[model samples]
Target: MATINTAVLDTFITLTGIKPLAVDVSPVLRERKAALLSILPHWEGAEQSGIFAENFFPDRSVGHRKKELDDLIAQTGNVTGSTEIKAENQLRGSFMLNCPNGNIRVFFTLSPENPPLIQQLDFSLAK
Candidate 1:
């Protein structure tokens, strides 16, 4: 089993302000609701027969994409800030969260399906 990265998890938790016990947002998390309720917990958990269970070997190397986000941030200066654009098949959102760190803008995409899936996640920090 792939061990969780505490450093990365901590940074994310700090950025998003997530509380384990307070994660009961199944009602508002439309996409998360489908994922948590539809898929059998065992599918993502252990006890798979290996024949049908999908397994993933994780990697944190995302330099290429990070560079692209860097470019976008450069293009969208502080004046531009954040924006959300929704297309027929896609829902895109970008925002500057209230982080202790200087201005930070994050861009993400969600599928237009009933239970949207996060197809993309990118972020940039103001210089």
Candidate 2:
């Protein structure tokens, strides 16, 4: 069993190279994460369009994005649970919003400004 484990680890290292060192989470990242979590409930409820407006980057077409999100909400049903897919960095991440009808995978990127706003957001049905 020990030999098997060693061989598996060796194969992984060969295929993927050495794993990178973990980065320390910064204060900015914590704030961004808090901002995202605070808005998730509003997203689940789908009641406050203003929340979306406020969080999204001003340069984006907020109305269009809201409409797209609304359509997704309509199709997916109520958000029953959520899972973070990727949130390694301060600037961008992806998450899965589980619903009764289906799951929606959301990808987002944040602006480089001091208080980073969501610069881009996209959603798709999870496979």
Candidate 3:
């Protein structure tokens, strides 16, 4: 059994070229992820006001954000399919919105507030 375990470990390290590190999910990160997930539905529906009303930081310009949202909607058209979270962290995240035209990549940053608020938002075509 010990020999088999050692052989398996050696094979894994050789194939991967690196040892895996244990990842610990922190509570703050969990909170940020929950906040982001809560807003994604509104984003998929193109509810600009819904997304911005509470989730966005108060200091950001609402008018500018609205314009950006409108442009994103115009480019993507209706969200004909499910939205996917591509990557995320305590302060930033990327999402893939499935649309009639194509998949659109949405990226956002969060403020350091307790619950965290969106400090910046942007979108791009997925390629």
Estimated TM-score for each candidate = 0.31, 0.57, 0.51
TM-score top scorer: 2
Which order, best to worst by lDDT? Answer: 2, 3, 1
- Candidate 3 residue-wise lDDT, 44-85, digit = tens: 433453333364546555456556656766877865554544
Which lDDT value does model 3 have at 62?
48
* The best candidate in terms of lDDT: 2
Scanning candidate 1 in windows of ten residues, the lowest lDDT window is: 49-58
| Inter-residue clash pairs, candidate 3 | none
Clashes of 3: 0
- Pairwise lDDT winner, candidates 2 and 3: 2
Candidate 2 lDDT, 1-127, residue by residue in tens: 9999999999999998888665555555445445555665344432342223354645555466566766887898977877744665667677778899998887767677756655566878888
Candidate 2 backbone overlaps, count? 0
Report the Cα lDDT for candidate 1.
0.41
